[model samples]
Target chain A: MTGTLFLQTLVDGLILGGIFSLSAVGFSLIFGVLGVVNLSHGIFVLLGAYLGLALKEAWGIDPLMAIPLVFGALFVLGGLVQITLVSGAVRRGSLMSSLLITFGVSLMLRDLIILVFGPDVQSLSSSWLFDTFRIGGVIVDGARASGLIASLLSLGLLSYVLYRSKVGRAMRATAQQDFAAGLCGIDVKKIYAMTFGVSAGFAGVSGIIVGLINPFTPFDDTHWTLNAFVTVVLGGVGSPVGALLGGLMLGGISTFSSQYVGSLYPNVFIFGALLLMLIVRPNGLLGNAYKGSV
Target chain B: MNKQISRRTALGLLGATMTSATALRAMPARAATDGVIRFGGSLGMSGRYAETGLNIRHGYETAIKYINEEKGGVQIAGKTYSLELGIVDDASDPARATTLIQRQVDEGVDFFLGSYGSNVVLPCAGITEAAGKVTVQVGGSADQIFTQGYENIFGFFPRASRAWVTSIEFFKSIEPKPKTVSVMATNSAFSKLNAQAAAAGCKEIGLEVLDVLELPEQVTDSSSALATLRARTPDILITTTVDQNSLVIARQMIATETNVPLLYQFLGPQLPAYRESLGAKADGVVMQLPWDESLEFTDPTFGDTQSYIDYYNATNDRPFSYHTVGASSCITTYIEAMKAAGSVDPLAVRDALDAIDIVTAFGPVNFTEDGDGDPILMGAKIGQVQGGEIKVVYPENLRTAETLYPTPTWAEKG
Candidate 1:
């Protein structure tokens, strides 16, 4: 590839990496804190995008301006779902039951989305940020650049919340050992609900960013969920910083593989890398972020 | 061609014929008691292609109304048989689609209608081709589908390879005509084939082929490809993409300012969702389509283009699309072939389909033995989305609007 082409791919990879990182941090959090794989995570993201789209079309609200609305709606729904379904599923059969329940809920919500929005692909357009900025020979589109900024800000805020707050301390304690944390005066169930809510809300925030950069359909939920899972696996299962490392790695691998290797080989390369990572370091590059010694 | 039957009644008749399969198998696809001829197959009604599948269903249902009530049914050897549709939702699953076709074949439904996209049609047609059943479809355009020597599978649409091959004349007419071109194709079987064919066509017509950018299957960005375009800056950019890919790539192209003088998407711009997403940005972006509403063609089936549009609009909640007509022509061709052969026999009708040239609501119909459609009819017209609507911009005589040559770049439009 030419030097210019290489530089462009590198820039594109970083932007894509930002999107992947923000979209997955919540998934990593949920997986670590609850030990319940949230298969329905992707739908929350889609719900945010759809909500943004509806707001845009119905009232001429910009997608960027509607992120808070989308985030609030999904956060409440996620908390309620954690209390009602996820907690009940965990009670019935632990992690496997939770997994199945999340999968079923994902399918149900996916169908609901189709019914509400139709199965057509949709993209978000912003009146405020639709321009192409150029730096010498490099071209940066406004949609992607805006998405990258949102992702970074969201990630930075999430880090502050996870490390510098009492709630963050409780969440980490519960993630490490819920029984011990409960004995130590942490309200384990409430913490779980809050973690799930935060994870889901962050997922929704990322979804709006995704909609800004890429065209999405209801069926794309599974793809987003899977991507987040891979990000966690490649970086470290439970850390925002790990999700960032993993997402950027994935973004680079995807772009380089598609550009230099072949268009058809990105998935193969990604999965192969995932398998290799698992074999080399089961705990991941930085290891679990929250889990402490039992 | 005067009588009108309730389209709902035709659907009920379609359902009614399912129970009379014992008589259907004993006879040659004809139910003696109800005079109902069953046409069944699997379509993607609830999956990735659900929208196109629903449109095809409307096309099939509408054609059934015309065949049974207006055209007085399929006349063959002094007997008439009303058409009944027996379709199942395959949900775009290749294995399930083939299995459904096989199930219908086992149950003795001889005539088959095709589903949308090559993925569904490829396997479904394989089942019908093996059963010695005739499948008249509009979706299977990949050259491998035809070159597979599947004689029973007839594509009533443009072959994937001939997409740009058919556009040669149109390109020749461009003002300050293009000399260099680039291609960006997604990872679908049809898209890849169409892109390769476009490159070949460019070479044939002496246009310099800068590059063929095969986009990642789940592409969110195209920076590397855009950079190549920036460096090369080809006069024209040809992209082979479907609705989703088109929207994503088009958005990316606009953002990256990877603007060319002309940009053409093979399929995406014609879809409603893509048009809605792009809005006025869709204008000047030319696309290739098998049928447009403006073609001045007349046939006994739907009279002409205007009537077809009217009937479609009267029934469907949405505006008319080209695929609806393509779907309707499948039934029209089967009826016309059976009438021409004067027999309801599967082999006889298939042979007659190979020979007869008849006009339908969609256009002309004549399937080559290799299962290709009438080339003259399936020209895949060049359509430029003008004034927020697609209009024919080529083949001079069928031109509905003037060709917006040297399509405005993204920067120019902005």
Candidate 2:
């Protein structure tokens, strides 16, 4: 309606884009390095948030301080989860079975979470964080600002690991060609496990940030997962930078539409956009640059 | 001769005493007065409808605890006996709910308190009825729950359609005659049912219904629904969804420059999340609530809105959400019925519930058996979200505060 309003909406979109980018990056990492969908990525986010919430509220741990602890915890949890459930499917030697196996694992984790967490919407109430900053007469939530920061941090760390570590090299090798990598003396299983763990650890970080930003219900998992999927797809499924651009684009479009038109129709718009993308740029923004395909 | 006679007499007395003691010990562990009144609860404590289930469970448990403490036991035939409660988590699954109900029936549960969702309760009602057990649909608002006409099925919550009519009566009080209504829902059975009932109610009241859209349950984006409605320049928008979805919808509506008068069904938009997310957009959104601060009940502290809010906030410590409200209310109702019935006898509890007036956090609840034998409780209040808070603005005397948005000029005609 006004210049100030439009600017405010754009700023809001940027913050949301940051969150989308953070969440989708993990999914992208897992797919790029491990060639697995890891369908339970959403559940891992939930678990991470719940764990963070529990630590802060139940055990009196500070939310910020709990991040490193959560990251470490989820790293081990991810490895164990993959070893126990996905291992069986992997051993069976069918690519399609991996998806099915992960889907089942997701379902089981979802139910198990319900059993432990019950059916209540939980939040670590931080009213002090509800403050807003007026930038050029446009308002933005203070907590969302912090969330964007956290998301960027997670994304940066993930990128660093991918580009600068021994594990990263091994992961890249496997992703390029698993058989050749195995012949090159890279333990493919260990690389896959580590990549999954890293991906989940990033998800954990996103979860902590999200928990601070919004009230989480277990049912919201589907929305988050789908959002991540859409982000991954738009970003070329495996490119870190592509995921970032895709998140920003979708986030900006959705937020702008929500402000200018209506928020309810974003899903329809997203689907339409996806269809257009499929036709126009099947390889996505960065294409094969980020993904070393098998 | 004297010693022999004394010894024989003593032996006879000892033998008689020993036999009587053994007979006393051999009797059933619980006296017939303590006859096991097995009450079964097949509840959805997890999944989409978990909040309602959990809240109702709290009410039921607390009431049971109070009843036992006050009377020292359940009063039956002018005698007191201990009460036992058994429950199963149905996870909002209809099949699981049915199985749980049957399992409880086999375990000899006298009365059944079913969960909050219609999908689970409807099927569970059939299983309980088939087993000849009386079932109280604890907090389910499905209109058909009563109309099913099963002799043993009773809906503790008021019918959704009736509630909608009452809410509209309040809406009618808004200035210009409201028109161009938009109906949005989560597509869940209960949410859809509420939306359908509201649409029907609006039609009967001669209001224009525009843009009835059903969104998936976890719709994070509500802008499209708002934009579509905005295109029509609707005077009032009605939402039949949970607090989260409602807040998102309302906020998006405001963002889209369509700040029309709004009405909501059982799901509230006054929750902290809604308020926080909607920010200034939360003001003046009207909704239907079973309980309002203005409504007083016979239970000194029981009927006050604050008591429920306090208990809920004390238990949850967050902003009051409808999920918690509905859940707690249902649980509280069941517990009160159990307390009154005392013996855990399903028939007795159902009879007690039907006969006695229930004073909950909402208001006076009086159930009349329908032709199909389900109890129909008729009571509702109109609330509006103001400054991130839900306040009553209905029935004049029942109004806790003023209505937010005077009906838009466009709504004046029909």
State which candidate has the highest TM-score.
Answer: 1
DockQ of 2: 0.21
Candidate 2 docks at the CAPRI level of incorrect
Q: Worst lDDT window (10 residues) for model 1 chain B? A: B25-34
- lDDT at residue B228 of model 1 (Cα atoms): 70
Give Cα-based local distance difference scores for all models: 0.81, 0.66
Candidate 2 per-residue lDDT over residues B256-307, each given as its tens digit: 3454655453574544545554455456667766654455544522445576
Each model's TM-score?
A: 0.91, 0.73
Off by over 4 Å in 1: A1-6, A92-95, A260-264, A289-294, B1-33, B65-80
Q: Comparing only chain A of model 2 with the true chain A, what is the TM-score?
A: 0.93
- Interface RMSD of candidate 1, in Å, is 1.8
**How high is the lDDT of residue A180 in model 2?**
97
